[model samples]
Target: MKAAFLVPVLAALWPAPALSDGVAGEFDYYILSLSWQPAWCRTTGDGRDAPECQNGSGRDFVVHGLWPQYERGWPDHCETRERDPSRRDTQAMGDLMAPGLALYQWRKHGRCSGLSAAGYYAALREAAEAVRTPAVFDDLPRDIALPPAVVEDAFIEANPGLTADGITVTCKAEALAEVRICLTRDLEPRACAPDARRDCARSRVLMERIR
Candidate 1:
C-alpha cells in the first residue's frame, strides 16, 4: 500500500450559539479591531465606498470588525445562518463599516457577545465613536517609518483613558495592518491581554498612505 499523507481539520461541534440561546454577556470585554485604511484601499478594494477612501478624502483607521471576545479565546456564528439584521441597526453604524458587513459582524461576533443584536451594534458604535484618532495617523505622509511602539504611544496620548496595556499594533509585510483596542462592556478602556499585545519583530515599519 502506498503511504497516505492526510491533513486534519477541526469542525465546530457546537451548534450556532444563537440558535441554542447564544452565549451572550459571557465575555470579559470587547475587542475593537481597527484596520489601516490604506492597506485595504491598496490591497483588497473591498470597501470601495468607505468614507475614508472616497474621492481623495484623507485616509484613516476604520472599523475592521467589532469582535465579542472572551479574555482568551473568542466565539463566532452564534445565530442561525440565515439570521438577518434590521436596516435601522445597520444604518446606525454609519460609514464605519463597508456594505453588508454590519450584519456579518453581528452574526459572527455579536451573538456570542452575550448581547442582543441591537445592543451589540450600539456597543460597536459607542466604541468606535469614543476613540479620538491620533493626529499623526489621521494624515499619513506618502511613506513614513516608525516603530510599532511609537504608534501605540500616539493613540494612548490622543485618547484620554488609553494605556499601553490596552492597545496592540499589528502589521502586514512591513506595513501597518491592524490595531486592537480593548474596552469593557460599558466601553471603558481596559488593559489588553498579553495575547493581544503587539510583538513586532522589527525596529520600525513603513506605513503606506491611502491611494
Candidate 2:
C-alpha cells in the first residue's frame, strides 16, 4: 500500500488523540515490505544502477521501505525538515533501495519512526536478512504461473511462525508485484490487518524473472 505523507500543517490537523501510539517509539508494529526487483524493473522500465538491472546486485527482494504503521492507519513526514539521514547512510543503503528511494523512505516513513535514522535502517537490514526467501523466488522462472496462495504458502513453509494471514501477495496486472509481510514491533510474524490483506482474485499470477 502507498503510505500517506502529511505536511507539517496538515499533519497537525489530526489531533494527538487521533494519533495512535507514542509519538514515535510506540507504533503498533512494523510492515517489512519486500518488493520484487524483477516485477518493478519490468513493470516500471527503470530502477537503480546498471548492476541491479544486470543482476549483479545479490538482492532478489529489495527494500521498498520499512513503514511504521498503526493498526488502523499510519503516519508520515514526522520529523521537521531539519532531520535527515547522514550522507554516509544514504550512500550505504542506496543499492538496497533504488536511487532516491533511500532518502525518500527516511524522509517519508523512517523519520516518523521513534528510532533514529541509523537504527531504523539497521532494523530494516536485520528484518530483510532474517527472512529466508523460498528457492523459487530466489531464482524465479520467467512467467511462471502460480496462485497467490502458493506464494503465501512458500513463505509460510520457509519461515517459522509466519502464516498465510500474515503474508499479503500484491500483484500488478497479471505480474507478481510484492510480498508484504507483517511483523510485530519486535520483528515477529503477526497477522496483517484485514484491510491490508491481499484481495486480488486472479487464478494465476506471473512471476517475472530477474534477467
Candidate 3:
C-alpha cells in the first residue's frame, strides 16, 4: 500500500509531459512573442502624453489565427516585439523619453517578464543606453523648411503620444517665427530656442517636435 501510495505521489511529483510538438511549439512561441501588458500601449484617439506602447501580445494572436500582420494593426491594438537585439535596444532607449514613471514601469516589466516580443525590444534599447555610448547623429539637409502648419502636423504625425495640440503652428510667417519647437518638454511655452525650433522642424523627435 505504501508503495502504491508512493507511486501515485511520484507520478504527481513528476512533471506532466509537455504538450504535443505542435501545441508545445505554438504555446512557447506565443508566450515568448505575446505582449502581456496591454495597458502599456497608448491609443491615438485619447490624447495621452507618452501613450503606452501598443501591447504586442495581440499580434501573437493574429499570427496564430491566420490573420494578417501589418504595421497599421499595431498602434492602439498590438505591441511590436523586435526579435533582433539591436532593434530592441533602439525601442528601449526611446521608451526613456516617456513623460511619466508609468512608461518606466512598462519598460522595466516588459523586459523582465516571460512574455517576450516588445518587452525584449525595450530591454535591448534600455541596455544599449546604459552603455553610455554616443549615438551617431545622421545629418540631414538643413535647407528644407516645411510650412509652419505642415510642420506642426508632421510633428503630431511623428509622435502620436503627445497632446493633440503638439504645436500651435500658425500659418502666418510672423507667427511661425514666434513658434518654438521644444524637445521633450512639450507643454512648456518658450521652451525651445530659435535654433532648436529649426532643428525640430527637420527631425522626428521622440518627445515634442514643433514647427
Q: lDDT of each structure?
A: 0.66, 0.66, 0.24
lDDT of 2 by residue, 1-211 (tens): 1111111211101123334333556467777877666665564434333344455343456567677778867777775434577778867875455436677777767877787888888887777777777876666555588898898898899999998788887777897767888888888889987656754578887776655
lDDT at 31, model 1: 77
Q: Whose TM-score is higher: candidate 1's or candidate 2's?
A: 2
Residue 80, model 3: lDDT of 31
Tens digits of per-residue lDDT for model 1, 101-141: 67667766887776677777777877888887787665565
Q: List the residue pairs that clash in candidate 1.
A: 17-78, 18-78, 24-114, 25-114
| True-vs-predicted CA distance for residue 64, candidate 3, Å | 49
**Candidate 2's C-alpha lDDT?**
0.66
Residue 29 CA displacement from its true place in model 2, Å: 0.8
Error of 3 at 184 (Å): 14
Q: Which has the better lDDT: candidate 1, or candidate 3?
A: 1
**Candidate 2, residue 195: CA error in Å?**
2.1
Residue 155's lDDT in candidate 2? 85
TM-scores of the models, in the given order? 0.79, 0.80, 0.18
lDDT of 3 by residue, 1-211 (tens): 0000000111101112222112111111101111111112221212343222222222100000001111111111123352323444433434332122223323332322333445433432333222211111112122234444554554445444423332333222222222222222112212322222222242222211111
